[model samples]
Target: MDKDQQNRITYTVYCINAFAERYRLTAKQAFAYLDRFGGMAFLEDCYEAEHQLSIIDAVNDLTQVCRNQGGKL
Candidate 1:
């Protein structure tokens, strides 16, 4: 990959790790929530650009799904 692509990848990883840390989430929980929403790559999109509430929205959506499935969120 080019230098720009490498930098972008590194930045994305940093941003996602920051978000997970901010929420006090384990990497496992963070990935699970993303996977549950069929959005395992959701972080990459937001990391590439500025995001408003999409990540939170996704977590909320995943929460609802878990609740409906009789599982704890």
Candidate 2:
């Protein structure tokens, strides 16, 4: 699901697990992608991966962006 579709933290959690399952990505791998690249990069990578961008990816990506922009996550 996309960020707008993630209605609750539990849903976010579910999306994370679903994303991991669908892509064979470890939680760490998924998180690292976001941490190193941020939202645009994450979305781009997802598109490159196969057109599946989930909310968990955005959470991590946005976190990375915040950190990069001095928000400290």
Give the per-residue lDDT digits (tens) of candidate 2, residues 12-49: 45544554555577866645544454633544444434
Q: Candidate 2 deviates by what RMSD?
A: 9.4
TM-score of each: 0.44, 0.34
Clashes of each: 0, 0
After superposition, candidate 2 runs with Cα above 4 Å error: 1-7, 34-73
Q: Clashing pairs in model 2?
A: none
Query: What clash pairs does model 1 have?
Result: none
lDDT of 1: 0.53
Clashes of 2: 0
